[model samples]
Target chain A: MRWSLLGTAVVLLVVFLMSQRQQIEVSYGQSPSSPDAVVEGEAGELSEATVPSVEAMTAMIDAEPVVRLPGSIARWNERVVREAIGDSDIRILVAPPGLDEAERGRVREVERATITIVGTKVSGGVYEATADAIPEWRAQFASGDVTTLLVPMIRHLQERESPAVDASFRWREPTAAELDTVTAELRANGSHVAEGATLEGVPEASEKAFPDAEALYVALPRQPFGQPVPRYGPALARTFPDRPIVVVYGSWIEYDGPGAADFAELVSAMFYAQFGTRLATYDYPQGNVLNAWLNRVTDVRYAGLFDRPLPYLPFDPVKVTMPALPWLFAACVAGFLALSARSLRRPQAARDSRHYSRLAGLTALAIEVSGLSGERSDPPLTRGIGKLRAATEALESGLPPAQVRTLLDDAENELDDTARLLGRRDYRPRNYLEGRLG
Target chain B: MSASWSVWLVGGVLLAAAGVGSTLVPRLRARGVRRRVAWSTARAAIDSAAVSRDACATRVAEAERLLARAESIAADRGGVLAAEEAARCAERADRLWRAARRG
Candidate 1:
C-alpha cells in the first residue's frame, strides 16, 4: 500500500509538471520558427518607419477615432496596441473609424501584418461610418465581424438599448455629512467603506483604507466620466448583490497626501482581494530597484492618472488530461483492500498447524529414545513399546492429551523396569521426558 | 486557474492521499497480524488443555477397570481387604481425573 501510494504521487507529480511545461510553452508564444528569425524578417520591413514612442502610443489610444491613416504610417501599431492592453484576451480587432479606400487597404495590411508578427490568429472587420451608425455597429456585431466590441461607443449603445435606470442629474460635490452617512449605511450592511473621487478610483482608495477587506464601498462622482452618463451604481450593486456596495455621489476635486495614501491602500486591497495571494504587489513600470523598494515601503502600486486603477487581466483557466493515473491509483487501493480482507479470513485451524507439527515431532523423538534403550526382547519392554506406539498414533490423530499422558505414564513405568532388567541406570521416566520435550 | 496553480492543487490532494495511506496501511497490517497470532495462541492453549483432560479421564477409566478385576479376583479368593484397597485406589484416581478435567 505504501508503495502504491508513493507510486501514484510520483506519477501525478510528473504529469502535472509536464502539463505545466506545455502550458508555459504555449503562453510564451513559442512557435515552430524561432522568434528571432521572425522579428528580424519583420524588422527590415519596419526599418523605413521608426517605432512610435510610448507617449505617442498612449496618445493614439486616447484619440479613439484615428481617421484615414495609412497602416504603414503607424509601424508596429499592433505591438503598441497589445502593450497598451497588457494581457487582455483580445478576441476581435476593430479598425479605427473614417477610413477611405486607400486607408482601408492600409488598415487591412496592418491587420495582416499584426497577425503575422504576433504569430497568433485574430478575426475582425473594418468599422464603417454611416448616418445610422448605431445600427451599423449592431449589424457588424450581430454578423460576428466584431465579436467582442471594446469601444466605449458599443457600451454606450448597449446602455441606450437597455436602460436599467434614469440617472440624469446635475453634477455636484458631496458634503462630509453625506459621505459619513453613506459610509455608515455601507458598514451597517456589512461592507468595508473606502472614500474615493469616482467609481474608477475606488480600487485604489479601498486598498488604502482596508488592505484585507473582501468587499468595499466607494463614493461615486455624479459625473464620473465628465458627463451625465448611465446609472452604474444600481447595476454594480445588483450584479454583486452579495458584495453589497453603497455609493456616495461626490468629487475629490483637489488631491492631497492623505487622499493619495488612501487611494494607494484601496488599490492594494482590491488587487489582493481579486487575485488572492498568488500575485505580488509590484510598482508600475517596474524596473528600478529604488522604485520597487519605495513602493514596498509605502504599500502602493500604480493606480493610474486621474486616480483610475490599472486594468486587471485574470489568468486563463487551465485544462488538464491525465489518462491513466486515476485508474491505476484506484486499482492499487482496491488490491490493497482485497489482500487485507483475504489475510483476515484465513482458517483458524490452518493457522494452528504449527503446534500440531511440534507435538508430532516430540512424540517421534520419545519413541526413538525408548528403542535406543535396547530392551526389545523383553515382554514388558515390548508391551511398553506397543503402548507408546499407540499413544504416538493417537497424538498424531490429534487425540486428547490427558489420555495420551496416562498411557505414557504406564508405558514409562514398564520401560523403566525393562531398562533395570537390562542394567541401564541412565533410563529416565515419562515426566522428565515430557518436561524436556515441552 | 493558471496552469501552475491547477497542478499544485492536484499535487496537494495526491500528497494528502499518499500520506493517509502510508499511515493507515501499516497500522491495518499490524492489527491483522496481531489478531491472527492471538487466535492461533488461544487455539493451541485450548487444544492442549483438552488433550490433557482426556488423558486424565483415560487414566481414571483404566484404574476403575483394574479395581473391578481385582475385586472379582479377591471375591473368588475370599479376600475383602484386597478388594477394598483396589476400590480405594480407583476412587482416588477418579477424583484426581475429575479435578484435572474441571480445571
Candidate 2:
C-alpha cells in the first residue's frame, strides 16, 4: 500500500506535468520565420524590407479582407472601417472626395474587385462609405451603412444595425466609467495598461514612468508622409524584456473622434491576442472580442510589433476544462490511502488481541491442570473449564475485541463460580492477572 | 480522447488498482492463511486427544466439536479475532490432549 500510494502520487504528478508541457508546447511551439518581421521606415511606415508589395497586399486582401497596412494611418483607417462594418459582407471603400477620375481609376485598377476607390457616386453589392466622401451615395443606395471614421457616425451606424446583430454590440467612444471597467478587467487579467505611457514624447519617458508595467500601451498620433513616427515598440521592449508593447498609430482626428473607450478595447484585444490564449486563464466566460476580430479578418499578419516570442495565433483555444475522471481518481487515491492506513492499523490491533488470547489460554490451561481432579469431580468445574476453552477458541477465531472480551468475561465468571465451589480463590483469568501484575 | 484526458484516465485507473491490490488483497490473504492454519492445528490436537485411550471420552469429544467450530471460522476467514480464537482453541485442545496422555 505504501509503495502503491507513493507510486500513484508520483505518476499523477508526472501525468499532470506532461499534460501541461503539451499545452505549453501547443502555445509556444511555433517559431516565427523571422525574429523581427516588421521594421519601421523613416516616416514610421513599414520599411521596404518588411512591407508587402502592393500586388501581394492586394492579393492577400482579395483572399481575406484583412491586411497589415504600411502606414499607421492606413491601419487606423482599416481598423475603424473593419470595426464599423463588423463581420457583415459589406466592403468599406476608402476614397477621399478630393481624388479625381484618373486617380480613382488607378485605385480601381489596383484593387480589382474587393474595394474600388470611387468618387462621390458609390454603387456596389453591400458597402460602407465615409460620410464626408459620399453624401449622395446613401440617398442612392439604402442598403449601405455610412460612417465618417468618427465615433458618433460609427455609433449611429451601430445603432441602425443593432437590430439585425447583437443589440449589445455598440461601437462608440467609451465613457470614463467604461474605461475604468475595462482597465480593472485588464488588471484582473494580469495586464497592467500603463495609463500615461502613450509614448507622446519618447520611449525613455514611458520606460521611466511605468517601469513595472507588464505591457506598454502607446497610442501614437499619425505622422505625415515626410515626418517620422516615434518608433517606441523596439525601445520599450528593450527596456522591459519579455513585456508587450502595443503601439496603435492613428490620425489625430481618429484619436479625438473614437476617444479612450475604443482605444482601450483595441489595446485589450491586442494584449490578450498576444498573451492569454486560454479563457481558463481569465475570469471572464465570454470569448475575447480580439479573437472574433482575428477570425473575421482571417489573414491579418502580425508583423512582430510587440516583440512576441511566438507567432500570432490563428485563434485562442476556447477553454480547457478538466475532466471529472481525474477528480474521481484523486478521490479514489484518498480513499485508498485511508483504507491502507486502516489495514496497517488492523494487524497491530489483531496482534495485541492475539497476545491477550494466548495469555488467557495459557492461564486457563494452568488453572485447569492444577485443579484437574476438582474439574472432573464437580460438573460446574468441568463446565467452567469447557466454557473457558470455548472462549479461547472464539477469541482465536478473530471475533471483534468487544465480543471476544465479553466471551472471556463470561468464561472468567464461570471459572470464578467453579473456584468458589472448590473453595479456592487463586484461579483468576488473564484479564484479572493483567490488572494484578500491572 | 485528448492527450490530457487520456493521461488523467490512465492515471486514475492506476491509483484505483494500487489501492485495491496493494492494501486490500494482501491483508485478506494473510487473514485467510492465519485462520486456516490455526483451525487445522486445533483439529490435529483434538485428533491426538482422541488417540489416547486414557483421555476422557466426553472432553475429547467436546474438543473435537470445538475444533470443528474453529474450522468453520477459518473457512469463513472471520478476521484477526477469529484467527486468535482458533489459535486459542488449538492451544486448549493441545492442553487436553497432553493432560489425557499424562494421565
Candidate 3:
C-alpha cells in the first residue's frame, strides 16, 4: 500500500514538473515574427522610402558629436540604435579613464568610421567632458537648445565634486498646463491618476488611486530643465520593486539640434526600463521591439500579471497553490503507513490470544480430571484433588507453564493410583480389616 | 514566477519527501518487529503442541498394555465382571489421553 501511494506521489510530481516545463517552453519558444508585427504596428505606418539604412544612421552619428552616458544607459541606447539601423555595422565608443598612451593608440587603431569618443578635461578641479563636436552635447543654457542636457542630475548630486553648471536653483513645481498635459497623456494610456503634493507622495497616491491596480503609473512633474533627472526614476524604482512603475514625462519638453533625438531615445529607454512592455503608446519606432521582447520575457517570469485577484502586490495569494499538491501527497503516504502498521500488528495480536487460550484450556483440563478423581471418597485422592486445585490457581496467577505442567503430572499420578485401587474388588479399608481380626 | 514562489515550491517538495520518509521508516521497523514476534510465538506453540502430543501417545500405549494385563489376570481368577470394569476404566483413560494428544 505504501509503495502504491509513493508511486502515485512520484507520478503527480513528474506530471506537475512536466507541465511547468511545457509552459516555460511555450512562452519562451515562440517565434519573433508576431512580436515584430506588434512592434511595427505600434510604430505606426512607415513607408519603405522613409526607412534609412543602418549605414546611414551610423554615418549620421559619426558626423555629429558623441553622446556620453553611463554604461547602463549606453547599453540601452545601443539596443535602440540597433533596432533602428537593422543589421548595419555600428559601434558606440566608451572611454574609460586611466588609458595610457599605448592603450589610447590601440583604441585609435581599432576605431572605425562608426566610432567617436567624447574627450574629458579638468575644469575647476572637476572633470568636464567636451560636447563641442555635437551641438546637442553643449550645455542647455549655452545653446538655448531644448534638446541638449547634462549628466543625470541625481548622479551629479552624488559626485564628490560639483558640476560646472548647477541646476538646483532652477528647480520648480510643474505649471498647471504641464500637469494637464501629463495627466491627459496618462489617461489616454489607460492609467489611474492620483495627485500628490510632493514627489515622495507618489507611492501613497498610487496606492490610493487604485488599491487593486496590478501596476502603478506615476506621472513625474517636469524637471527645471527639459532634460530628465536620474534621482526620481531610481527612487521610485527602489520604493516599489514589487510592482511595475511607469514614470510619464510631459511631451511638451522640447529637444533641439542633434541632442533632440538622443534625449527622446533616452526617455523612451527609461520608460522601457521602468515598465518593461507597457510603453504607454510612445511615438518611437524602437519601442515596438523593446516592448515585444520585454513582454515575452516578463510574461514568462510572471505568468499572470493582470488577471483576477485585483490589487496585485508582490505576493499574490491566488498564486500560492503550489504547496497544496505536495501536502496532499504527504497525507496519502501517512495514511498508507498507518494501515500497514495496523496490518502488521494483527498477527502478533492473534498469536497473543492463542497463547492465552492454550493456557486456559490446560487449566480447564487439570480441573476436570481433579473433579473426576474427587468422586472417590479416599483421603489420598481428596488430597491429590486439593493439590491439583492449588496448581490450577497457580497457573491462573501467571505461573510459568512448565511449573504448572509439573504440578498436573503429580496430580495425574495420584488420580491414576486412586483409579487402580477402585478397580480392585478385593481391596478393603485398613481400619475395617483390623476390626474384623480383633 | 517570483523567486519566493519558487523557493516555496521547492521547500514544500522537500518537506513532503521528509514526511514520507519519516512515516515509512518507522512503519518498516514496526513490521520487522511484528514479524519477529509472530515467528517466535508460532515456533513455541508448535514445539509445545508436539511435546504434549508425544506425551499423550505414550500414555495411550501404556493404558492399552495395562488393560491387556488386567483382562488376563481377571480371566485367571474367573472374575468376568472385574475384567469388564477394568477394561472400561482403561478405555476411558485411553480416550482422555487421545483427547490430550489432539489438544
As a whole number from 0 to 100, the lDDT of residue A140 in candidate 1 is: 24
Kindly provide the TM-score of model 3 when superposed on the true structure, using C-alpha atoms. 0.28
Model 1 lDDT tens row, B1-103: 3554544565566556655765677677556544433332222322222333344534455544644554453345423344344435444444454455445
Instruction: Give the top-scoring candidate (lDDT).
Output: 2
**TM-score-better candidate, 2 vs 3:** 3
Best by DockQ: 2
Model 1 gets an lDDT of 0.38
Docking quality class, candidate 1: incorrect
Q: Estimate each model's TM-score.
A: 0.21, 0.27, 0.28
Candidate 2 residue A269 C-alpha distance from true site, Å = 27
CA lDDT of each prediction against the hidden true structure:
0.38, 0.41, 0.38
Pick by TM-score: which candidate is best?
3
- Model 2 spans with C-alpha error above 4 angstroms: A1-345, A353-379, A400-403, A424-438, B8-103
Looking at chain B only, the TM-scores across the models are: 0.51, 0.53, 0.44
The local lDDT score (0 to 100) that residue A94 gets in candidate 2 is 38
At residue A95, candidate 3 shows an lDDT of 36
Ranking by DockQ: 2, 3, 1
- As for DockQ, the candidate ahead, 1 or 3, is 3
Q: lDDT, candidate 2, residue A214?
A: 45
lDDT of 1 by residue, A271-388 (tens): 3333221111111111121122223323433323335354354555544245444444445544554544454553342323433453454345446555665423244455455556
